[model samples]
Target: MRAFDLAASAKAAAQAAVDAAAPDLVALSHRLHAHPELGFAEERACGWLGEQLTEHGFTVTAGVGELPTAFVAERGEGPLVLGICAEYDALPGIGHACGHNVIASAAVTAALALGAVADDLGVTVRVLGTPAEENGGGKVLMLERGVFAGVHAAMMVHPSPRERLDPTCLARAQLHVEYDGRAAHASACPEDGVNAADALTVAQVAIGLLRQHMTPDQRVHGITTTGGQVPNVIPEHTEADYYVRAATLAGVTDLEERVRDCFRAGAVATRSRLTLSSTSPAYSEFRHDPGLLAAYERNALVAGREFPTVTAEDDRQAGSTDMANVSLAIPSIQPLVSIDSGDVGLHQAEFAAYAARPAADRALLEGGLAMAWTCVDAALDEGLRARLLAGATAGG
Candidate 1:
């Protein structure tokens, strides 16, 4: 067989293997969806993923990077190290509404399928259990600790309302602001109190006005956690959480400085002491490697999946993810896999329900097979691999 024919055949075999593992994969996905854990607290999800990989003959190492929820599983050996990134952290209250269960299962399925033909493909497969993507920068921490050291390329499929090869994800910076003031009875001696709530109001108004000068793609929003204990008394202290995003990390840094200035202005305007802290490191923008994306798009099409053509308007509405940080370090793809969750958007209770439904199960299987085939194509096609490496290195 010619090289392309060999790759096609290997991909076919991998898809068949994934089909055979469909039942187990679906069950695992449902289990994870049913018991959603948030961010750094995904201990149960991490253990389950490690056990599944271990059972599938991959050497599993739990607690990677001193993180209780992080793990690394490896199989095969060769110069090309293919990384399958898995995320299991759910949203705080709505749970697996973002379909992390699908992500976790897809990674496992792809790793197993690729491992079955790793020897012939001449590549290594590593399944990385990266937690806390919703809040803490788990992958960023792992990257800093040398967890991804030798991986040639990394890949993961994120569940979304639509299927797309490359959706623009914004760089993000999270801020925590606290304002301190003096308390007094609301109706009595109100003049003696410095209102922290007034400080937050000032900051919010400034942010609203700042939006007029920002790029249309920029997003600045936040919630006040503690406006006041009671309406009868002035609030002695108030806190708020804000997330500011931009098209790139440098843009995010600049926007963040302006946001801090707004907070400082609020302090000055309200006579309250303001303190600002970053809750997490900034998440960078995603860098797309066209060669790798083309391979993935081909594999996805063969697996009966089609991605929609996204336009500038689509780019205007973007979300932030730590996966962007991974793209900066290595060749990575974070394509969206649709779950047919209706109008119920991510981080909603209804979407969480769909995450365990039959449609989601099908998405898990198809996404896994497609990602596995993409890896095979990458390893079997030398030109494409070199292009991906070059693109990643140049972008880095």
Candidate 2:
């Protein structure tokens, strides 16, 4: 059969498979949402996703990239390899607040659907059980360690308040700052202590002042993890975790240096020693493949998913992700699927509550089917397939 005819048949089979497995996928989403785990600590979520894929006849490899919670499940032996990313990490205080449960479930649904038609479509389907998206850059580490090697294309759907074909994904760097000083009794020897807390205060003030000079796309945000021990004792040690984000990796690097200088200013002014370190690998800006994104948009539209017109208010929805780093190396797209959360945005408790609701379940099913259809379209399009194959890198 010709590619187009095969694509039609495969798309039908893929959609049917997803429909049949909808209950299991929805259950997976709810289960993960109920048992949220932090980055690099998603043993249960990883095992559950791997088990589902294994039961569907995929070859599952756990701990592929030196990450205990990371796994890769593959089906088919065709030349065209497509990767589906599954992020399952929850936020510190908010369980699945970022809707990663939906992301993982949708990815699993897509993998199951595509696995059913992999041979007909002449494609290898991989469901990458990626962990630590909330804190550590698990995808970044995996990409560097060759977990994504030989993949021609990558795709995933993220749940949001609204649908978007190409939402802004900024490059980001996680910064861990530390300050050291000497502790002395506040009343007896106030002059002998070099206050580390005061040093952190100066750094925060500097960052606040620097914000006035920053561009709209640049962002610096963090929380003080440790400040002091007691009210009567001068702080001897302080630490904070901050994230610096910008339009690109180079921009983030530049902004990070400046932010480091802000921390340095704090140490210098307060006579405290300063130490700066990175929490994880830096994330790159997303480079959505034109052909893949267009295919996804068409499929999603056919599935009754609408992409609302971008407004000034929508610009604030931009966030950071390690998948953006994958996009730089592979033909990829991470489209946003709306769960009808209205004004409740991602990373909030209210949104987390909506992540397991009916709307999110619908998003999971539709998003997975749409992604599977998009893969079929790409696999059948000769020109697009050739382009994706040509762009494939060793670790892509």
Most accurate candidate by TM-score: 2
lDDT (Cα) of model 1: 0.88
Candidate 2 lDDT over residue span 1-396, tens digit each: 987688889988988898889999999999999999999999999999999999999999999899999999999988999999999999988898899999999999999989988987889999898889877899999999999999999999999999998889889999999999999999998999999999999999999999998999999999999999899999999999999999999999999999999999999999999999999899999998888999999999987799989887777668999999999888899999999999999889999999999999999999999999999998889888888888753233
Clashing pairs in 2: none
- lDDT at residue 20 of model 2 (Cα atoms): 88
lDDT of each: 0.88, 0.92
How much does candidate 2 score in TM-score?
0.97
Q: Looking at candidate 2, what is the lDDT of residue 310?
A: 86
The CA-based lDDT of model 2 is what?
A: 0.92
Stretch of 10 with least lDDT, candidate 1:
387-396
Worst 10-residue lDDT window for candidate 2 reads 387-396
